[model samples]
Target: MGELIVIRHAQASFGSDDYDRLSDLGHQQAELVGAALRDMGWVPDRLITGTLARQKQTLRGMGFDKAPEEHAGWNEYDFHDLLRVKFGGTIPDPVQHDRKTHFRTLRDVLREWQGGGVEGARETWTQFSARIASARQAATREGAERVLVISSGGAIGQLTASALGAAPEQMIALNLQVKNTAISRFIFTPRAFFLHEFNATPHFAPKERAHLLSYS
Candidate 1:
């Protein structure tokens, strides 16, 4: 079976303007993940990432000079658009408040979107899920044994939920828990892909890099 390694993009400029750019720490996290992957004796046969700057930057930061094939299907849903549509152009700022409240608000928005409540969403939840499935098919394409996909948390979470045949709400848990540069593994056969692991960050050992672990 071909193995697919899904890496969530490294930490972006969290709480900063232009959240699509990778922070200095994000670069460091990527390097660590790259080194850890090499240490595990795994080199990707193929590299894939979304068109997003953050996703591409994370791939570059991973110390691979090779160019990756861009897959827009792996691109994340636009949170700003979702919120604006859901709330009639009023986008809420969660950073000004507490963590619990921030997460609660995001979960609510996802729930609304999943239930088709987001009034003007360009891509429905079904569309997003279908996109993820397309990406998976491409990942397991012939001649690609060890495939690496660098994408955002939401897209990865959607992929995970779809793989497990879980309920829509379960995706919120995957989204909330995925860490920056985290590696989710799957064994891909011609028929289906089995989840080997989800949200594993072997690179960031608690004793050495506890502070570097970031969810955003």
Candidate 2:
């Protein structure tokens, strides 16, 4: 069976003015993940990444020299926008900068968004799920024996949950747990797609490197 290796992009500049770029630690995490994958001989026959800068940067840090095919479907939902929309055009200060409060609010907002409670959301829950499905179809195409994809935590969580026929709430749980630079794998054929692994972070298994593991 063909294999698809999906990697969530490394630590982004959370709470910074720009959250789309990877942080210094994120770069290190990406490089370590790349080295670990290489040691396992899990090189990809094809590479794909979202249009986001963070996704592209993660792929580059992975040390793969090939040009990756860009897919917007792999991009993350606009959480900042969602927060603003949910709050009637202005994000609360706590949600804007405090990690705990931000995620707490996010969880509630996601539930609302899923149930069509968050008005003016740029993309509805249905649309977001549909795009992920479309991206999976593209990634699982017959030509490549092994495909590597660089995406965000939200997209990865949604995809995995969808693959398992799990509830949307499970996606939020999975999304929160996915560490930066974590890897998830899938085995696929034209008509079959199975989750082989989820959120494996062998690179950070060493005690010294354990401190490097991060989510958000």
Candidate 3:
């Protein structure tokens, strides 16, 4: 059986001008997860990452020096742009700066976007979903027994939801709950793909390290 391990990129600069890069704590979290995987004797035959700085940086921090294939299909949807489009070209101050308010508003906006309510967005829900499917196909191709993929929460959430034959709203819920550097595992064959785990943070599960767990 082939195993596909998808990792959500570590915490990003949530309220910064450039949210595509990982924060200092994000790097630490990536390193810790890398160590945990290595200790578990889990090594991937192939490495893949979305064409985003945070995704790529997470892979690097994980101590994998191998050249990874870059796939745009795994890239995250633009939530900022979606928010702007949804609210007449401006993101509310509370949503922009407050984590609680941001996610609360994002949840509602994502549902609206999925239902074809949000206009002037770069990618529609169907298109975003399609690309994630394509990316999954590419990652699970024959030849690699173990594949590691680094992606953002939205793409990973959508992928996991689709694998479980779940509704779109479940993706949003999963997205909000995924912690930084969390691992989601899938077992696959030529004809079937099954989700083995979702949003697991074994690296930070210890009481001493629990404070490192973060969702952003």
In candidate 3, clashing pairs total: 0
Q: Model 1: per-residue lDDT, tens digit, 69-168?
A: 9999999888767867766776556622345766677788899889988877899988988899888898789998999999989998988988899999
Whole-model Cα lDDT per candidate? 0.87, 0.93, 0.94
Model 1: clashing residue pairs? none
Candidate 2, residue 108: lDDT: 92
- Per-candidate Cα RMSD to the true structure, in Å, reads 1.5, 0.7, 0.7
Better of 1 and 3 by TM-score: 3
Model 3 scores worst on lDDT over the 10 consecutive residues at 86-95
Q: For candidate 1, what is the TM-score? A: 0.95
TM-score of each: 0.95, 0.99, 0.98
List model 3 lDDT by residue over 1-216, tens digit each: 999999999889999989999999999999999999999999989999999999999999999777899999989999999999988988989999899999999999999999997988999999999999999999999999999999989998999999999999999999988889999999999999989999999999889999889999
Q: How close is candidate 3 to the true structure, as a TM-score?
A: 0.98
Candidate 2 segments whose C-alpha is farther than 4 A from its true place: none
Please provide, for model 2 over 68-163, each residue's C-alpha lDDT reduced to its tens digit, 9 standing for 90 to 100: 999999999899989999888989898999999999999999988888778788999889989999999998888999999999988999999998
